[model samples]
Target chain A: MSTSLYPLASLPQIEKTPSREDGIPDGLEEELRAYGCKLIHEAGILLKQNQVAVATAQILFQRFWFVTSMKQFGIGDIGMGALYLASKLEECPIRIRDLINIYDLLLQRKAHIRAQAMASRLASTSAHPRTEFKYTPMSYFGNTFYELKDALVVAEMQILKRLGFNLTVVLPYNTLVNYLRVLGLTSREDVCTKAWGYLNDALQTPVYALYSVPTIVCAAILLTTRHLGIGLPSAPENCWWELFDAEWEDLWNVCGYIMRLYRERTSEDHTRVMGMVAKKGVRQWLEEHRPAGGEGH
Target chain B: MSDSAGPSTPSRKRSRWDIEDEEAQLEQAQQPVKRRSKTKSAKTSPAPEQTRSSAAVEPQRTTAVYKRPPHSIFVPPRTLHPPLMPSRSVYCYERLNSIEEGSYGVVFRARDKETGDIVALKKLKLDEEKNGFPITALREINSLMVCKHENVVGIREVVVGDTLTQVFIVMDFIEHDLKTLLTTMPAPFLQSEIKTLMMQLLSAVAHCHERWILHRDLKTSNLLMNNRGTIKVADFGLARRYGDPVGVGGLTQLVVTLWYRAPEILLGGSTYSTAIDMWSVGCIFAELLLKEPLFQAKGEIELLSMIFKLLGPPTTHSWPDYHTLPLAKSITLPPPQPPQLRQKFQYITAAGIDLMSRLLTYDPEMRISAVDALKHPYFSESPLPKHPDLFSSFPSAAAGEKRRKPYESPPAPVRAADYNLLTDFDP
Candidate 1:
């Protein structure tokens, strides 16, 4: 019997603020941005091969952070490799050889050739010398191809269960970038920058695997236009902005820092455009005309 | 324009988007800097000093492209070096400059104030910041305080002043954990070394069991040795008194690590006895034999499945009263499968594998006790036993003699014949 899977709930909605009054601790934005960059570098190296193992590893690291403390796992380095292992168990298997090569390439930028040689030497003693590693629990998982496949299935199911089964809805960062490409913004390295930023921010927020569809859409819109150099699109007609006001407000709350960064990167102040941005206009109207100077009665 | 029109609510929502300025005000209010602080001083104050050190040391040690807000210790900067502590404290133990943090606390190689001899002073981090030293930690400290075994990590003194700030449990600090030792080995441990470790672990656990204490978290990370081959179980954070009532909920499963978690605990069996620790010994044995975790699980669910798959399903007949526990009903186990150890661990010796399986039984009643397990024939054969006197020169052991200079050379290696001697000593 097919079971109806429940979507993971997003964290409680928090309204966005004006005037920077909420006190974003100084430097928290920069820290998260830096974290975003490292994650991109790591994911980019794996995605270049389009290998399932690498992708799974990257995603697994992302998922692990949703539960347990991420501080202990190098903020997600080892977690990347673990995702690769999980991917190997999933039907989306990639060659271990490709994993090591990508891992080497990722490190090669900063690692000396000698260090690469040592890491490579350690990498070579696996059963599948061309692809596997010395310590992979492959033998425990299987010797035969069929057994390997079965083990992968087991590992996938376990990982899903372990992660609280927060799947079904996925936030595809790469897909949003592709959308930017379709929008004629491919030349810029910064295309859909806010989208990627929002996607990453969504991962850390409590509602990661759930309640993120609208956030994703708004981010895609903001990031695409920011990179297109036309700036954020003037609010669309038919009040599409209001149709998504609730979700947009949720997005704005979780992604206030990211939106600010987008504004900072694009050379347009959000406040200067508040009169033009429909979503912000509604909040401004409410704040200005409300009794008691809009402070709660 | 549609405000006075009937059935215009949808139209108003649509027009709201037409006028971009309406949403613009909302966008202007989107800055994140104004959030009020959620931190309570009661929770923030009295955090363990080690945590503070790890935080402060980050900016000094690396280029640190990320400047994190001082709150929310959850996020670490990319490319962080594990905090490197000086061997001597800036305060009391002031002769060393490089100490390493361990599972329970920090240890520094320092000279004793009264005695000029250099000793490793392990200051246990048991403050409230460390969740106020869980019951397991108390057992480790209280139990080790009474233990005089040579194989055990020795507790020198419980340094207590008038206040909680002044308390620090001092121990004889060793150089490295077994995890560190195995990392340095060129290959997997030779059988002799494995046997030696088994003997040492059994001796210590047996010592603890005799004194009504259990070394709950027995793993390579918890076992430390000096450059010499003397093995001592280090962290007592999870060690607990065997007969003590469940002092707190959610603690029985906290003793052993995920990989080393016993079947009973995995099956949601709580309110355990010393056998819970024997299960950890079983895991360590297999890990030592295989050079990795034996029943490796991605997390708790799979870990339990791996256990049940290897040890067969646990039934009330096997584990009496297991179903009565609060979480037992929550676990839905698969049908029994005869554990197939030999097929999996082909490299391990038949005898060695037998001992491991026995120690890892699903039923605590069926699991081998530390004392009886130590008496198992495994240790009777192989490499010969070295006299305990060889470790007499251990600085802590020799505290009485005219400060005999500490041994700088590496500890002597154990050979396979040590197993032969065990067999000869056996029937």
Candidate 2:
């Protein structure tokens, strides 16, 4: 009932990674999660959702994957479902048709980029002219569009059911703003903007699900101040993070996660992961891990 | 620990001590029932063999059958997990009767088949929603979860039916709604009883406000009183979190019921806050004294006129930001006159009148907050608020109990004119 019901220390996913139990490699699991969260962010932008709605969607997606696994559920379907559900939770309702079209467009865009990357690599190797790729939008009357729509609805219910219908997600943006004002840093536009940017970037990882709002906000502030070389009031036993109830270790840990997100070779990881999944084909991979009843279809 | 769920469990299942403990740990606070604690203990100490045996003997007694793994999403393909225990099917409860229908949902009195506990099941209306789920219902559930207090109605769980459209919100069933109680009673609540009810209402409102939630709709109908005399604030469909930006389009103008609506909302103020809920509380206070809605106007214009007549026209001194409202310029101000609050409630004490006036102040900034209202002298006067336990119980109309006619009372008057004539004749 309380927002702090699942503290950072007590979350089941934080306690034990579910993907690992499903035989997924640790590094690959982390990339898949980051990619899934990135998909939510991109889908949110395509759907023209507000930051809170987008953040809520990202957190829901992360929370869903924490309990479930990529082996069983498709990230694209669940990510779209998270956004669709978050739009409703945050009182910003996105129509099913618009959601489906935008998601389709996003997936196509990703495929197009991958195709371009492959074409460039092949051209460089064989000294052949790179091929041009023209993208076509999904048709309203197409079977694929209708099928995607059905998948979205089913995925939404699955997400809701899996998450136990606890749809209220407390995002750190509000906390960041509040903390900034309290720390007398609101006037510093650079610090405020940087902290906010850190929050947006932090969403790429599982920080939102694993860390409390105050901890995340404090981490953002710490990261922002360090980046800008801004001095904050710090005396023995009166540390600023301590005032916000953020532990010293947690603040640094969140910062480390955000930094790792930047240092990771995301494109290379994405290529390898996609190639790994591609060997079996996405459909066949999903089919192999599908639960007996095909409940989420 | 098994003793907690033993033979005595049926009667002593939801003891007050359990509720107090649940409330003490607000973060993990769930229903007063013993299922959660039982599950928690079962998880830590593996007594599953005994639990399974008990489950076999008394299938309905053990809620362990409903438990799924804490983190697994596909324990059985499509089942839910801990905390959101697979929402038991709606068929788990037997419908007693329809309670009432609201714009957002329909209420029904139902009995839990397993526990035989009575609960109020609110079936959200999803058929007309073009949007996947109504934001109002989401806000209601969110607010209810956030603002959990004894004075606030406790939401047990959400149960689903055969189809998604048949979602039902299970809440602790109270015996009577204040509106029905007032209409049926021969006499209005005594001053002490009214004070007690107001205190309970104010406490609930204060609890919600402290959590940054606004119960935008507060009226007599939304107040439920149990046989024990405890009153709980209910119907949070119009409730939402405030203090943050209301988003791009701004908050909706339509919220509280017409009779209980605040002046700012009626005058097209888009950026209202907790003050609006305070205004509704003030109206409810007056309704308790008068045994009817304070403002029974048919439309916005008429409601505004009624408000102006009762509180006098809003002056520059009373409301500094009156001219800033969108619809402020459309109205012609009446000649200034003093508030007729004392004239309306002729028997109310000076302290009560002062408290009522503060709550009904024209300026939102000047309106009394629930926290401040709780410390007001009105509650400390002679004939102080009665304890909830001491308050007399009435026949529960919700349970279909017919009200006994008032002793030696004349036949009910058919209309206002007849009532007025009878009063005049008696005088």
Candidate 3:
């Protein structure tokens, strides 16, 4: 028998972020990633995907950017591809048709929101804070629809290749719940809800790829308890994080990243980042590099 | 001075600018330049520019190896180099012959071009894929990685073809599957040989369960054997990780082949664990002994009848939750009768009977686990398991070897009377 490739000890490591090397401006990579993760979350909800699948898709999207540049690939195509692949991995498969339609719908909704924001700024209206927007689904038989479909297929393979077929992602949500139960903190509604929110927010960052599941879980719990002003045993001899193989340094690092995610959320505008990176979308790039008679059909 | 200067003038000019341009182009071709060193050496004597450029590029290539951060949690300490490279193309291996096509994928016996090593390649069926990549393939790959053991088949790597539909999984090629071995062998395996095969199978199953994976489909055909007596468990297409809550929709009922399926599954049980795999292991155990499948019935009803005949009807004592099953209300229970295990295998030792009976128990909770079965006294009894290396080898049918003919026997005698001869003799 051949030696095992992906022993727990030797799983693929978090790669160096190539966005800076590819000349993407500082802080923009994080904005693009957050935008991409949001795309996965909204599309996942629209398609009725479970939390695990959505979380897995978010991690895949973050990991893809670790080796690839946002300038080279569009966030929408890669985000859709990640969701499509994650659903399969989690055993809750969504048809590609449904996936494409929902993804296009979400993109249109974002565009509508952005257009309204632009129109309101132009009209200089401060009275009307909210405007009702109705969504019109894209035509299934249009060229744009087929182009997106082809881009989705190509993006799936591109993500698979860029990630080196290491599709197994161990999520920390289950670990967090189990740890809470072990600590006899399941009944603490505030702590559970806060920790759950922290875990969801952590997906928008690179913490999922950078740290182990236990460390992430510990960070979430630690941050939640501190924020709620609830105390847990932290004495050196009986510290809780050590039981889950989480060091103090790693836990703090994870907590800091998660905190930064909330602190920096105010500056990122979706329309500006989308305009900056979506100049040569993944679909256009695919069409330019597409072989004359490829097998995608 | 003029003779030497005239010959060297153009050459010196070429080396100044042209060599630098060539070096720039070579640097953009990220693959290491070692492959072109031989051609470079062959032409370097004629052109000094070629020699100078080759020397300059060598040192730059060597420094290109990536270094991980000191405190990086992603890179494991033991691996000096991780497989960050893209998957190799499927063309790297030449297809020797087609192996059996399964529900999830089609397998082929292939030879690696560089290594000349024979490997089994399973090409996933993506042509009819409507939901993107299939979950079965994902589960199979994930479980195989998590449950790596000496007794389990090793997955080499995943390679891809030109199109999206052409992903292939490379695995170690084994000589025979136990099902074909049983039918083709001249005689049934001796007790000692059976013990060795069983021990290996149990070890593999125990390894999988230890890692929280369930090989939902376990049959003789999925058990691969080498020329030596070692058996490696293969075919994890139906395998999956099982844990608390058993995922969103719960476990599916459409798993494990009908003949090897556990009773609870046939009775519409949705939540199952390692017990289901243990039941399949029991079916495989029976097949190994009988030299055929234990329950060869055509349908689920007939299979249940066969199982009832061998292990007796399920009573409250045997299966406490039998009536709680979804299908329990529709089907009526058979009349109570004793198990026919002793009658079926009268020659087996007491310890052997005990182990088999424990494996084929009516209640899944009562079924012996793979780890416990490994410690059974039957293995330590007289005529113990033969050493895998000491066992004789047979020509592999998968390699296209002809079978050896068995010795001829006398024809059966025709009887004039159809009645029982023993009763006539007594009268």
Docking quality (DockQ) of candidate 1: 0.03
Tell me how each candidate scores on DockQ against the true complex: 0.03, 0.08, 0.10
* Model 2 lDDT tens row, B319-405: 999999999999998999999999999999999999999999999889999999999999999889998899888999888888675
Q: Which tens-of-lDDT digit does each residue in B84-162 have in candidate 3?
A: 4457899999999987878777889999999999999998887876555667887888787678788999988888899
Order the candidates by TM-score, highest first — what do you get? 3, 2, 1
Q: What TM-score describes the B chain of model 2?
A: 0.75
TM-score of 1: 0.39
lDDT of 3: 0.75
**Clash list (residue pairs), candidate 2:** none
* TM-scores computed on chain B for all candidates: 0.62, 0.75, 0.76
What digit string (tens of lDDT, one per residue) describes model 2 on residues A11-30?
Answer: 33544566666556566667
lDDT of 1 at A277: 17
Evaluated at residue B87, the lDDT of candidate 1 is 21
Per-candidate iRMS values, in order, are 21.3, 15.4, 14.6
Q: TM-score for the first chain of model 2?
A: 0.86
List where candidate 2 sits over 4 angstroms from the true fold: A1-23, A46-48, A92-98, A118-128, A131-133, A140-147, A173-198, A214-260, A263-268, A272-283, A286-297, B1-88, B91-94, B113-116, B244-248, B403-427
TM-score of each: 0.39, 0.75, 0.76
Give the fraction of reference interface contacts each candidate recovers: 0.00, 0.09, 0.17
Candidate 2, residue B223: Cα displacement in angstroms equals 0.8
